[model samples]
Target: MCILFVALEAHPEYPLIICANRDEFHHRPTEAAHFWPKQNRLLAGKDLEAGGTWLGVNQNGLIAGLTNIRDPELIQSDMKSRGELVLKALINDGIDESWLARYSPFYNPFNLLYGDEKALYCFDSRAKRLNQLTAGFHSISNGALDDIWPKMSRGTQAIQAHITNNSNPCIDSLLAIMKDGTQAPDADLPQTGVSLEWERHLSSIYIQHQEYGTRSTSIILKDKRGKVQFSEVRYDGKGRNLGRNDFSF
Candidate 1:
């Protein structure tokens, strides 16, 4: 997941709300969100190339999502896939900080958000820090948790406003916010070592590109009653909708 907006206990009706967009190369093989055949309790989209998921939730209300840190200088071609972290987190009882501390170096720098409905935490692999998220609005992108990048700020505000105004926010409404394609002004863009042109292309909440862009948007909502709803909408290289999947348990 390239960007994720989370509202933990910030909504009156829902205690947990997550809206995220996964950006990647258009040609990578993927599967839509579903109950994994080998792990039926897990629901998430699969990255076929790496055999892991970018985001997933299990039957116990445990949730996990990942985003790569945007420093190209730190990338290692042979590093392990960061996607596997999400799988390990969902299946485990809870995040084992010591275990993660020991193994994080094998993977590229990343931000892993993992927790159950009662609590949420974000582990910054680059800094080797674990943050226990308080009850409030939070946004995580290619930077540390709640960094003020333009796109991050814009998306965080958008979701906060939507939830504050609507007592009963719908899935389509939340998904629409994630569809925003407004790019940040050139002066407002962060210098993340990418070419200016490439930075501009990725400055929006919803990226539009033929090669690398947002391939899917996922929304997860858990109400006060402990019921959960998971939804995903897929897109192609040209930014056209392919299909959608929705599940509740």
Candidate 2:
């Protein structure tokens, strides 16, 4: 997942609302969101190359998503796949602070967001920090949590506006926000070791590079009744919408 914005306990009817986009190289093989056959309770898109996932949820009401830290300097080929982190958290119902602390050191720098129905947590490997997010709105990208990157701020603000104006929040509005392709002004772009051109390209919530870009946009909503609505819209390498899947539980 390259970008994610979550609203927690913000709406009376819904306890959690999430909008996210998963970015990757165009050629990487991936499967759209679905129930994992091996782990019958799990729902997520599979990273065929690594046998893991970027985001997922289980019937136990556990949700997990991950984003890579933009640190080319710290990346090592031998490090474990960060996608595995999301899968591990979803697979084990007993994962806790101790579990994250013990195993976090093995992977490359990453930002992991995971939680049960009651609470949400974020772990930043670069800072070696873990935070239990309070009830409100939070956003995460390739940087620190809620760091106010232009894209994160835009997404959160859009969500706030939608929730304030509409009683029944729909996935279409959230997906529209995620589909925005407007690039940030050059001055507002975050310098994350990539070239200025690349930074400008990634500034938009929806990335459209020929080689590496957003592969899918996922919106997940969990209400107080334990019902979950999940939708994923996929795209081809050139930014053309491929198809979409919707499921409710």
Q: Report lDDT (CA) for all predictions.
A: 0.93, 0.89
Q: Quick one: best lDDT, which candidate? A: 1
Task: State the weakest 10-residue window (summed lDDT) of model 2.
Answer: 93-102
How many angstroms is residue 62 displaced in model 1 relative to the true structure, after the best TM-score fit? 0.6
Candidate 1 stretches with Cα past 4 Å from truth are: none
| Candidate achieving the largest TM-score | 1
Residue 186 lDDT in candidate 2: 94
lDDT of 1: 0.93
In model 2, the runs with Cα more than 4 Å from the true position are: none
Scored against the true structure, residue 63 in model 1 reaches a CA lDDT of: 92
Summarize candidate 1's per-residue lDDT along 211-240 as a digit string, tens digits.
999999999999998899999999988889
Residue 9 accuracy (lDDT) in model 2: 90
